[model samples]
Target chain A: MRNTFRASMALVHTTLGLVTGWVLFAIALSGSLSVFRQEISLWARPELSVTPSDPLLVDLHALNWLSQHAGHAGAWYLTAANERSPAATALWPDAKGHYVQRMLDPSTGSPDGIRDTLGGEFFYRFHFELQLPYPWGRLLAGVAALALLVGLISGIIIHRRILADFFTFRLSRGQRSWLDLHNLLGVAALPFHLIISFTGAITLGTMLLPWTTLVLYPHDITASYADLNPALYSRPASGHPGHLAPLLPMLKEAELHFRGTGLEQIYVFNPSDRSSIVTVVAGNAHTVSTTSDVITFDGPSGKILKEHIERRPVIRAYIFLYGLHVARFAPAMTRWLYFLSGLALATVIGSGMHLWCLKRLRRPGHRGHRIVFRLNVGILAGTPLAFSAFFIGNRIFPATMPDRAFYEVACVFATWGITLLYALLRRSNHAWPELLGADAVACLSVALMGPLWHGGYITAVSMTALALSVSFTLGTLHTTRKVHT
Target chain B: MTWISLLFAQVAIGFLLFGSERGKRIFFEGQLTRERQNFLKFCGTTSLCFSLLLQLFAVREPVLDIIQWIMGIAIEIIVAALLCALWEKEHNRFFRAASQHLRK
Candidate 1:
């Protein structure tokens, strides 16, 4: 009976690991890169590499720019530059009802002339959104997370000698080595994998299971959100033109009210009207809560209006999980740990896929095995190459090109599609080394070109490029050795 | 300071585990008695628990602090394991050379 149970669990674990491993790898890889999203953004726009000023000074610059460019709009949203990001940014609805964003110089209070690109936001959004239509991408990601959770649980159940295997790793034994690596990586950081998957699922809980919200709110998610976060509730615009007071004093007051917590966002509702309201939301730097404590002010008078602090235990618990999933509050060392953990998880998935292929390859003339092997090679090796191509495109593309950001994204998919095509056409033994070698060359080119173009030897962009080059070079060498052996 | 201490503690735990009979037999040509094995296991567990406790007190927020500790410890373990693996390879090479010299 115990053997039967173990057999069933092994089957289940293998099936789920093979099925969802690719998707999980994509999610984990992109999510790991997104951990350094702000830094990547800074690297992308070289003009913004200057030292960040005080938050208040950055906020003032952003607000001044907004007043000059978007004062006639319905509302304005300003995000102050922080330690990680050097450019203060603003977003507002234009006359045609289209939302527009402008990157402001923190010191000059004017728009910076950096080239338009998606920057690191592509990976950040792709991690969950998957570049698909609304809700569906997030739903798919949630399902992937669920699959990962199941695989983790069943994997633990099937590994009979979990503790004994923890310290056992035998290299160069082919299948045995692969299995040992899979077990070691999966079991060593099992807790982190479990927490990350669970929180990731919960982060999209509302989107994945809208029935709960439907049953609770019945008709209005907006109202539900306002109910959950009272500070989001705002009165209708009075529609009478009124002179607005400066935001500096209100910001100071809100900071004091929040006990010196950094202010993250400033939202101005009905900016040109009498019923204007300015809301200041606290940053998520010191706590495990993504929900910001907010203080709203009467815009014209600059008087304190309403303050909303999270008090409910249930909401606080949700906030904690949300913060864990997003990891916006982590310090530098902790963030690096998260990145490394994510990379390890990605390796676990990749190794599982390889193991599945190995088990199938033992059978001769298996068409499905070849297809799976090719697809794995394409995806596992193609993604990093695609990322490098995207960065290269960002540099080579003209700064003034229309819809340049979209083209940057197009460049990524195009490179990825070509890689998949090449993988399908060529044999696995040849495709692996060639693609990895190309990736190494691409990464090294980026590193070498950064100094010539950006006039810097050790900037963040160059350093990242150099690191990626070394990694890809090592990957290429490993693949060559594996093929030769 | 917390991260440094956590690193040292985790590496110590890794060494203790790898120094036991089971790990040594797998990685190195060595053996240990039952008592010494049990002692090493106990020490590793106690040091791990104490390191976690130190992490808890290092940060103010409960959930974030726990998450930080988990990531920190996981990274340290990975590093320590890799280091042990390298050390095992070196030890095997050294012993192989000594045996060859004795035979000659």
Candidate 2:
């Protein structure tokens, strides 16, 4: 092995990418879809017709429903209707104290009777959570993000001629073309790649690095959370039952206080107590920082008790980092950039994985390479296939099926598992085009089905899927004809 | 729309630079005049700053707009690279017309 600094970095570039490529690929692709999470949610549940409704009225109805059904819940949450998502949502503690969330039809102010599915939230959650239980998924995602950071830095070191190579792309040369593409994409979105990764790792920092919190609060981990993300105002519930003042007026008051960005989320704490608090958080339509300007009102009097706009540099820094990752404040144009760049990142990971396989294929004893090649094919091609299958499952499953949300998730994993099994079982050369061909079909199906069942900007998702189908078709054809170096 | 304008402006800078003798080593190669090299660098830098200002004035979210500007610059490099790589003389229809009109 060469002992130069660049060579060592090249080793790191290859190793880190190989180690984290599949997980990063999954995260990146899901993240690209997650960029349009709300739009996809609308497309998934076509039963909810888009109707212009007053936020105040919709929220009032949600409060009415909550007070009737879950009035005694320790707390209640309601999200106001927005342009992208017409239906509001209500979340409250169930009989078991665990949270239950349901969509509220703006027309009725009651729990929506629409088809049950996680919708776009499946991808948004899967982007970070990977459908695994709680902290494990977050931890894995955080680690993969960190690995991506190292890989990027190493790639920069190895790519000494970054400026020189910026305009050079020799197409149709198999391994060389992939190398150029990987470098091209990496360089093209370097700033985005750096920021997204740094912010992503920081977004899950508490979970990934528990020791940081432990250092500050040796005993009370909860205290650390309180300091990190403090409520606008909080208090213990009084034993004596007290009124939660009419919510619509308070919401209107908050709207005036927020000065027209609109109310995002409402929290009614200790709903039945004299010490009750209603915390209204501002929407992120106006600011880059994710920290909401909050106004906590006296539940009995419907007057503001405390208000907060985050100004602390330390906390604002943290909020800025988190907001950069979530991008709740981004407009449509910025969101598209996030989506397109995320796809480029995924391409980089896929090409890197393929590069690893391609290099080893030249060796005489290529048995180990075969396993990697199979894994690579299964993951790189299988993921988008499974993502499309999730949408397909949404439409194909009977609307009234119990636990339909779980079935949608299962469809994704099952498709992924079967593809993996097929890849491993079949010859690599045959597996490549076949899996990609299936992906193309699934994408095409997702694209064509959207107009039939849904309308509005949800066509954006369909159009994207249509584009993916075309790209996959081209890739499939190319794979069938090309011989790897 | 603002994003597109910023991107296209950056690509114009790309075109200007790639229009040179393999812009990468122009300074090193000494084939181009020193004044011309400096002039090219000035145009590219000025275009980038102009795009940054456009980004700033277009949106309320300054922080996100700045981040967007950086990413836009990064992406434009690729777009410019692709055009340079794949497209030949036929692609410079506007540029050819401008030159012909100037000669006339």
DockQ, per-model, please? 0.46, 0.36
For A229-287, candidate 1 gives per-residue lDDT tens digits of 78865888887897579888998888787775578788998888898989988877576
Per-residue CA lDDT of model 2 for A1-485, tens digit only, reads: 57899999999888888888999999999998888888888788877767877777878877888888887899998877776677777789998998887777777777657788888889999999998999899999999999999899999999978865766665656788789889989987988999999999998988877887788899898787566546567788888999888888899888887877777888999888888899998886677767667889999989888887667798889888888888877888788889889999999999999998888898776777889899999999999999999999999999889888889999999999999999999888888989989999999999988783445566787888889899999988977775352
lDDT of each: 0.80, 0.82
**Model 2 ranges off by over 4 Å:** A96-98, A229-242, A270-275, A452-455, A483-485, B1-11, B14-42, B88-104
RMSD of 1: 2.9
What is candidate 1's lDDT per residue for B1-104, written digit by digit as tens?
28655765775567566655447675545666667677777878777777777777774666666777777766665665566566667777898999999999
User: Judged by DockQ cut-offs, is candidate 2 incorrect, acceptable, medium or high?
Assistant: acceptable
Candidate 1: misplaced stretches above 4 Å? A1-3, A449-461, B1-4, B19-22, B26-30, B59-65, B87-104
Q: Candidate 2 has which clashing residue pairs, if any? A: none
Model 1 clash number: 0
Considering the true interface contacts (CA pairs under 8 Å between chains A and B), give the fraction that model 1 also has. Answer: 0.33
